[model samples]
Target: MADTKTLAEIEQRIAILRDNLRELVEQAAGFSGAANEELTADRINEQQAELDELLKKRDAMTKS
Candidate 1:
């Protein structure tokens, strides 16, 4: 139902998604004491799921 995303839009989305994913990775790696032991396996799964879904959406947009 939505129109296709422009190349710039797709790229911007990818960059944003990548940044979010990088932050998650940093948290998972225990970058700060506040994040240490706070990101459990379940939390990681949820974060990864969100990223995965976004990637799928991005892929579909590019395919179209």
Candidate 2:
């Protein structure tokens, strides 16, 4: 049988993925030109919030 992961484990993986996405977003920022001046903290925060919600859901699943 395949190895099983508890809910906590899943949440940790989701958090790691979020961090990777954040790093990618930061790297992409350097390439943003005048055409894309709308990149702001709010956008990144929104992404973070989305990731947080996903992690929360993963955590909740483990409670079942």
Question: lDDT of each prediction vs. the true structure?
Answer: 0.65, 0.65
True lDDT of residue 44, candidate 2: 65
Error of 1 at 55 (Å): 0.2
The ten-residue window of minimal lDDT in model 2 covers 1-10
Question: What C-alpha lDDT does candidate 2 achieve relative to the native structure?
Answer: 0.65
Off by over 4 Å in 1: 1-39
Please identify model 2 stretches exceeding 4 Å from their true place: 1-20, 28-38
Estimate the TM-score of every prediction: 0.47, 0.46
Clashes of 1: 0
Cα lDDT tens digits, model 2, 1-64, are 2124665566677777688677757766775665443554456666777788877776567555
> Model 2: which residue pairs collide?
none
Check candidate 1 and list the clashing pairs.
none
Report the C-alpha lDDT of model 1 over 1-64, residue by residue, as the tens digit. 3355565575676677677767767766765565454654456567567667767776776677
Clashes of 2: 0
